[model samples]
Target: MFLTYKDLSELFPNSRGIRDINLPFHTISSFAEQNQPKGLFIPLSEESGELGKAIENGAIGAIWEEGKEIPKYTPNHFPIFITNDIVKGFKEMTKQYMKKIKTSETKNMDMTKFLFLEEKLLNENFKTYDIAVVEENLSLYIEQLSEERRG
Candidate 1:
């Protein structure tokens, strides 16, 4: 969530009387899914239906297609980014966000090994389990990996 309000403003430079947004947004998401509070909402549809949903779900900012009639009820202060191509606007925003994120590769565990780990932990049966403890599970996982390497 490295995105700042300045970044958003730069992404969609054009707007109607929306100079500064009061609340800062942490994430950008579509209108369909309700993200956490303080999200910048982008609609898949040209229709205004999703705009209302965004508002209800606590979207601090929005992207509106340029030349599309702005809704009368929309507050003057609400930051509505105006872009020629709404779809491309959001897509570009997503692309920028993707670049900022750091992704890690994961090893896919075999089902038998997964079941063995589950069995071992189930005996201890803590109500809240965060994959048990790393120290306790590391040896078991290493043993399994060594077997796989041999096979």
Candidate 2:
């Protein structure tokens, strides 16, 4: 999650593009702020100093661009993922992780069972209804699971 300055430059190539980067969840001030240990993104720029700051702030790991020398200030314990383009690598990694999460969520849920329940709830007019209710229910179920996991 941590993006070094060099990584950002190589991956995004445009400074303006870096500011527009979006992540799945809320981007908090510190990675440790989340309940679970998450990835950190630090643009390895001379000015920001987020890479060093993040390490001091409890970031577990960072993504560094390949062919770029690691900054002398980088700490030893913070693991780094060296890639050709840090931003692209971060996006791809996040996408793959999200897909895995979605896949796992639906793995044990029977589509037929869900359909049957929907039909029963909406009667024969189920075709006119959206799946918002189903999605909400699933979301709640996932939230409960996440809470349980955290506990």
Candidate 3:
């Protein structure tokens, strides 16, 4: 149930892509190096170097700010979503992902028993002890399956 570029397209209609819109991305990662299974890069700066780093590190695609110069290294067929407000667009995409999860999987789950979140969308740096550290770390990795946690 991973989200595809097509799913995000509905959220950002001003996007530009010359490739397949159905490419699946399971995580939303900011740091390029940590993505084991490809991720969607969220451009935090208008610098092409930053975007290029993410791409070179294996970002499947990115949400590019309108008017920002894309890196020359970017392949012509790469998917580049254009948005006037990067923050708003990023928020909308994650929010919709959560909504879809709630209406689908988490709708029937008992919250007390399973504290499931779309951990893929959240890359946390933990500072906890022993089992707590492992627990937190494992939680982040668990949702990259079967469409991930429903919110």
Candidate 4:
């Protein structure tokens, strides 16, 4: 869940163009106020001083643009991800996470189908084929999402 600022930039190519963009992670002030201990914080600069301040303020890590010289003040203990564009990386990561979650849901559906089939067989009922039709519909929905993601 720790995304560097550089990765976030790649995911949001127009970030520089926009004056404000809502970050996926909550703001540090909000996190502090809520006493939330776990979340990612992406700083906008590779400057060591700025990054160090963010880390000191409870940032778990950072994502910085590749080729930009990291400031010497950055602590070695803080994690960093260097990327060509942060926004794109963030978007790609989001897509992958969504796909994994969908796949897990599909697996759960498969288990349910097995259970239904078993029950039908035990009752000597031949209507279990209906489960296949339902599964086909589910598959179609998943396929549509996949196609949209690809586009």
Candidate 5:
């Protein structure tokens, strides 16, 4: 599911909002290469250099560590969400979303159930490709449902 910047702020009240860029984002990644224009980036360390580079490459925002001073970049345009416990927060939120998927609907079956079936077909390994495919399908399915509801 997608999470707007405001939703993230609500989920993480302690997180500091930088530049107040309330954009919708999905997926979280630590790798700079994996960072997307609409995804949240969590740097490996509190290094301004890395974070700056990430923003240079189109990373929309970052999840910063709590109480840590932000970098002294010339223009701090990217939004930042500070967290007391980044690992725990990310894990708990991801788990919550997975649970939400279990209850959400799909085209012909429950999203979670269909994912389980797909995993079974793939010998239950549930490789990265399997997860990616499932996520893509579910995203499209959710969007279609939203459009239909609006119509």
Candidate 6:
């Protein structure tokens, strides 16, 4: 999936705003060698100055520990997402991405099935609801409802 730094900031607004590069990254990798051309590099325990290596290898950005010092030699303009807990942040991002995937896959599915899924989702007990999580599903339902009204 393609995501710019702006999109990331929108999804996780706490993140520092970096460039608006339209990098399409699919997965996050720890090792620079394994990083996909547009993927996000997460430097978990790199030696003091290794962030540049990851960026040089084609990572669009790096996610580093919140308090860890950023390498000075690394270009200041490169995007960096800092988190107190990298694993948690990564999992949250993955969950958001997966929802997008599921929604995209079901966009053309039958309305009845989508309705059932929406109902099931509503039945789940959460302390608070996030509308964005179910937005795509609801959009399909709304479209179908509108079409039924017109017909």
Clashes per candidate (backbone, < 3 Å): 0, 11, 0, 18, 0, 0
TM agreement with the true structure for every prediction: 0.56, 0.41, 0.63, 0.39, 0.57, 0.58
Worst 10 residues of 2 by lDDT: 111-120
Number of the candidate with higher TM-score, 3 or 4: 3
RMSD of each: 15.5, 16.1, 10.2, 16.8, 12.2, 14.8
lDDT of 5 by residue, 14-129 (tens): 65446453476654455555435565776533322376666665667677768767778725556777777665555444455565555555334322222122321334332243
Better of 4 and 6 by TM-score: 6
Q: After superposition, how far is residue 122 of candidate 4 from its true place, in Å?
A: 55
Alpha carbon lDDT of each predicted model: 0.53, 0.40, 0.58, 0.39, 0.53, 0.53
Please provide, for model 3 over 45-101, each residue's C-alpha lDDT reduced to its tens digit, 9 standing for 90 to 100. 322237667776677788877897887878877788899876567556655655554
Model 6 misplacement above 4 A: 45-49, 105-151
Q: Write the per-residue lDDT of candidate 4 for residues 4-107, one digit (tens) a residue.
A: 34444445443222222233333221111122222343332222235545555555545566776766876665445566754444335445434433455343
Worst 10 residues of 4 by lDDT: 111-120
Tens-place lDDT digits, model 6, residues 32-118: 654346657765333213666667766767777788787787666667777776655655554565565555654443211111222
Ranking by TM-score: 3, 6, 5, 1, 2, 4
Judge candidate 6 at residue 100 and give its lDDT: 57
Runs with alpha carbons beyond 4 Å of true place in candidate 4: 1-36, 44-49, 104-151
- Model 1 poorest ten-residue lDDT run: 109-118
Give the top-scoring candidate (lDDT): 3
